[model samples]
Target chain A: MKIKQISIFLQNKKGRLYDVCAVLGKNNINIRALNVAETEAFGVLRIVVNKPDEAVKALGEANFVANITDVVAVEVPDRPGGLAEILKVLADEDVNVEYMYGFVEKATDEALMVFRFDNPDKATEILKKHNIKIASEKEIKEL
Target chain B: MIWNEKFECMPAGELKQLQGERLKKLLPYIYNNCKAYKDKLDKAGIKPDAIRSIDDIKKLPFTTKVDMRDNYPYGLFCTDQKNVVEIHVSSGTTGNPTLVGYTRDDIKLWSEVMARSIACAGAEPSDTIQIAYGYGLFTGGLGFHYGALEMGLRIIPVSAGQTSRQLKIMQDFAPKILGCTPSYALYMAEEAREMGIDPKKGNWKIGIFGAEPWSEQMRTEIEQTWNMLATDVYGLSEIIGPGVAQECPNKIGLHIYSDVFYPEIINPNTGEPVKEGEDGELVITTLTKQAIPFIRYRTRDIVSINHEKCKCGRTSPRISKIRGRTDDMIIVRGINVFPSQIEHVLLGIEGTEPYYQIVVDRQKHQLDEVEVLVEVNSKMFSDEVKQLEHLRAKIKKEIESVLSIGVKVTLVEPKTIERSMGKAKRVIDKRQM
Candidate 1:
């Protein structure tokens, strides 16, 4: 299943992240899972949100560079080596994962991982063939 | 220790007469030989006979770097290519480079002036000189080379860089004169200390520094570091290189060889001659150049000329150290860099906004470092760090290729670079000198 994630461009300046959070909170958009990719000059703030489209619109209106990216979400067992086993499958099949972050599903108390893959459709199909439970956009918003 | 006392010590009234005679011949020579000068003069409605003396030089139209670029390769040469013995090209603002040609006699003139410049720095005929100015089209290294040859001084034509070897040669040969850019002279001093050598203990006696502007504070630093008399030498390729004017041991204003290359200072905005000892744009005319002669060429360098007698007894008019430039051009490590050139490179690259800023800084005991800041737009921004880094590298590569110097490319937030009245301010030079 494909998930929509909102990515905000953050310059390495004071109060940039606080400004992003303030804008999101004012718009009543809830962030589900977040990860920051940082370099010396700037950072990319990527978050899975309850309302991806509305969050991106608010960020754009606030003069922040924001866009929606398609990512694959998979459910993992609440155990050690869960992420490693899933990663091994992708590595064996030569499917590249750009980046990944983890969050816990409150309903089933299961671990869920968000992955940005080079080819999201191929990654989704491979995980489906392997009988792994794929989390959908509905599951993201329900959280 | 004046090199040629006959010309260097000539009385002021006599020098002006010789300058007038040279200018009298130069006007008609360029008028008939070079079409660019002829067209410029014809457009100004001034005939060759209108210039009876050097005093009438104010009547001539001013030539600029843009004019030289428009003429390109050989369009400005007064003599035939067969008589041209050498050529040098300096970087222009954009597109075409400024070209200069030297005839055999012009090369001799360069040598004589350079010899005088070296001697003005207090060099004796028996002393050795280590020339570290770059050679080739730059016109710095060979300019000093010819001068050293003319003076019959032992020369170590090291020709810039190779820091450890430069220190080794300085230790081995013990040259009396060190010729290079002032910044490089300081850089060498630092390198020598790093190699466990005392720069002050070296056998260097005189430092002939030019090709870039330096402050008197820098002069004190260099002199103390090397235990040598550091003097300033000034020149541009358009008029003969590196031997136009030089500061004598007296540390007064640099004495201009106005006998051959007549100097004038004018208001940059009004084009009217400024009063004596007042700062303005420097205008030079090639009075005796055979291959390429210029009439009242606007050098864009700001300075003031002193006509009073120097304590050294050289009657040549002395010009104050260069204060600034009339244009948006800067010299970084002896290379001319215009902001327009950087802007041109940025505009050519897709996804980059036309707005940018150049930051030049010089740390103590180091050469200059340039950092170019380009604002990141939504279209160029990416969620991946690698993609953003790739874009920065691309901008860095394109700019370095255009400027021929390495620079650091920094990506900033949109609107981070300050703006005043809706236009982004371009350059921020933080170097103290």
Candidate 2:
């Protein structure tokens, strides 16, 4: 299953991250998982949030260049070999992961990992064939 | 399209003779009429009567901005105060401002030259021009205003600012010619898009952009932005407003009306003339100016000149687009660096906004440090960090290679750098000493 992720462009300026957070907070957008990819001059802020379209619209209104990107959220068994098991399944099927970040669900025993894949559709098919549980947009928001 | 065939197409020999005659007459007139020129010529031990031809113009002394400042308002005017019809004052920024007084005849001459400048930019009598240059003491607005009236073009006279109103007028009146500074033209385009109008689809077929030094790369950017034939118009208040020279459709260089305003390029420090096609400071002499005639006035604008005839068949000597101003050239570690040079390189590179600011600082014992801040916009931004880093590194490497100095390139957010409705300020030097 695919989930919508909000990606924002931020220049490496003072308090820019705080400004982005403030915009999201003012709009009552709940962030499920977030990570920043940073460089010397600028940073790309990626967040899995409730109401991705509304978050993007709010950021755009504040003069932020933001857009929605499709990313797969795979459910991992809450065990020592949970990530490795899913990695092996995708590795055997030759599905490449561009980037990934994980977070443990508050009430569930499973961990949720957000992944950007080279070919998302192919990766989604591989996870389905291996009987690995995948999270949907609604599941990501409910987390 | 050729405004005045007799003067514009005069043969080289005849033009030289005309310039020599005008120069011979101008020297005596200024020396006799104005006390400033009298003292300068007497101090240089040159007799005004002995200077017979334009060749002897070198023997005369150069009039610096200090001369204008020392004279202040109305001291260097060659005519009586009663004869002066209007006056324009330039922003001094440092000391006393320089004043230029225009007699009725001088205004007529300005109108004639500006009419030639407008026509040189491929404007016709039927075409309408929306002049965005500021009016009042600034010469740009009224210069184009007087010229368009002379050329019989429908005038909009929307003198600068009011971005939304300017766009609305462009749509409603459908003026074919737009006259303003190049930076303001770009700003207008940005504002036009924000107002839900297509900039390139506008009806501004010709743009006469001047009042500041701009690079050829900037010309291309403006041309692509508005889909207009962007031409450079060159002039100053001291010389005679915005009609000193103009670029023809050939786009090689701006044709200086040498018969009326004689031009010579000289080394800024040595005052010696440079060879043809060599970049140096431009010095102009108002050969026919009545109110305030300048004899070899040092313009301080760096440019090269071409004496050869242009493809447009104008025999007037053409000057290259201003490379930089002597006043604007910042020396970092004994190396000359121009903001325009960095702009030229930046415009050549993809994924860069034209807005940039150069900051220079010096410590007590350390070498001069230079940093260029460029704006990052939506078109230049990416969703990956590595791509943006690559962009920053590319900018630094390209600027360093072009300037031959180590420069720190800082990518700033869009609109961080100050925008201007007139001349865009591009430098910030913080060194105390």
Candidate 3:
């Protein structure tokens, strides 16, 4: 399954990050996870929020630069090579990972990998055939 | 920095004597070598030997910055072109760029004067100076680059960019002094606060900033925040880059290098010399320059002058700190303002970054409205919406207090101040020039 994430473009100035935060707070949106990819002048704030629709609307009202992206979330065992197995599966399917980070929480017996790639549907289908546990919107929001 | 009395007692009469002797020799050289001047001299019905003294310069036509640009790329060199060692150019946005040529001896003299200026600011051979000015065609960077070397100090040639890199070098190596623009120094200070570093607790003792006009309110804020003395250095590429004159320990006016470059305050109205302690356009005549000598060149900078002896021992005439460029003066709502006045007020206020722009546009009924957009600082912001609004109100109040004019204050987030790699644009006027 693929989860939706909203990325906000932010300038690296003092009040820039605060302005974005203000908009999100006003719309009663909760930021579940965030990754700030930055250059000298600006940063792309990649966020997994509790309410994606609200986040997008709030960002739009504020004239903030933002976009929605789909990413796949998979379960890996807590054991060391559990990620290695997932990578091997991804390798066999020829899926290239532009960037990847882990969800702070784990399910009953697995850690979740929030992986972004060029093609999300193909990645989800390939991982599912390998008996990989794909996180749903509910699962991702809980994490 | 301590001021020496010996330099102050040297009279203007003595400086003028050397300038007169040099002018006698320079005019004939320009008439023979420079085609543009040869023509101008003929059209004005002037002879090379006609300018025998400093006052005789009034009879000769004054060269403008545009004249240098018009003769770009080798039109003004008085000495053999092959003997010219290096060329420094001004950053020209609207027209051809002006060029300053240097011979081997001229370069040596420039570095020596720069060393003296730096030393007067309390810098020593034992200290390390971090130079953050840009390098290359822009003289701000390389001019100081050579001066630092000539001063025999340990210099970290950390060319101007990447505030983080500058902080890292200042932290690790602990240089006692930093040379850069006032805005860049403020940027470094803001970045330090963001990164959890305390600039006041660091090793930097002083900051030497110039290349643009600033105000006293700004100097106070910088000195207070960085806990270091922020001094000013003045020069233009057309007038020999960053080593024309500098502020001594007195911290008031800058003393001209009278022995090398003669200083004259000419009435913009009468085209004649003004008495001492009067505001007029600055005119410089290079005395010892062999590459390209300027005779009564009108530099459209408006400033007041004083011939009184300074506490510093340098016997050079001092000009009241430059108020602003005459050419850059803008009239808004029929009131004249140099952008420096607005910048001064914003810098004086706490919680505001040093980056801002002034926009002049027509309102209903063709009235002009002035808008100053300032970059809102992040370190002071909070989750509280009231706090952000309060910051805006505070900025509006400060600007109104300083400028005595109500301005539309727009607070933008960091990095929102449009970035310029060189020669920042701070003012935009809708009026046709």
Candidate achieving the largest lDDT? 1
User: DockQ: which is higher, 2 or 3?
Assistant: 2
Tens-digit per-residue lDDT, B1-433, candidate 1: 8999988889988988898898888888999998998999999999999988889999999988878888888888888999998998887888666889999999999999999999998999979999999988889999999999999999999998898999999999999999999999999999888889999997879999999999999999999999999999999999998999999999889999988889999999999999999999999998999998888889999999999988998988899999999898989889889898888888888888877999999998898999998988778877778988999999999888777788999888777788989999888999977
What TM-score would chain A of each candidate receive against the reference chain A?
A: 0.95, 0.94, 0.89
Q: Rank the candidates by TM-score, best first.
A: 1, 2, 3
Docking class of 3: incorrect
Residue-pair clashes per candidate: 0, 0, 9
- Expressed as tens digits, the lDDT of each residue in B2-56 for candidate 2 is 9998999899899888999988888778888989889988999988788887888
Residue range with the least summed lDDT across 10 consecutive positions in model 2 chain B: B89-98
| Per-residue accuracy of model 3 over B157-233 as CA lDDT, tens digit each | 88777788889998999998888777567667777888999989877677787775656776777787788888888
Candidate 1 lDDT for residue A8:
80
* Poorly placed runs, candidate 3 (over 4 Å): A1-143, B1-11, B329-433
Top model number, TM-score:
1
Clashing pairs in 3: A13-B414, A13-B415, A14-B378, A14-B414, B4-B312, B4-B313, B7-B313, B7-B314, B7-B315
lDDT value for model 3: 0.73
lDDT accuracy of residue A49 in candidate 2: 88
- Tens digit of per-residue lDDT, candidate 2, span A19-68: 99999999999888888987766778888888898998898888787867
What docking grade does candidate 2 earn?
acceptable
Model 2 lDDT at residue B151? 96
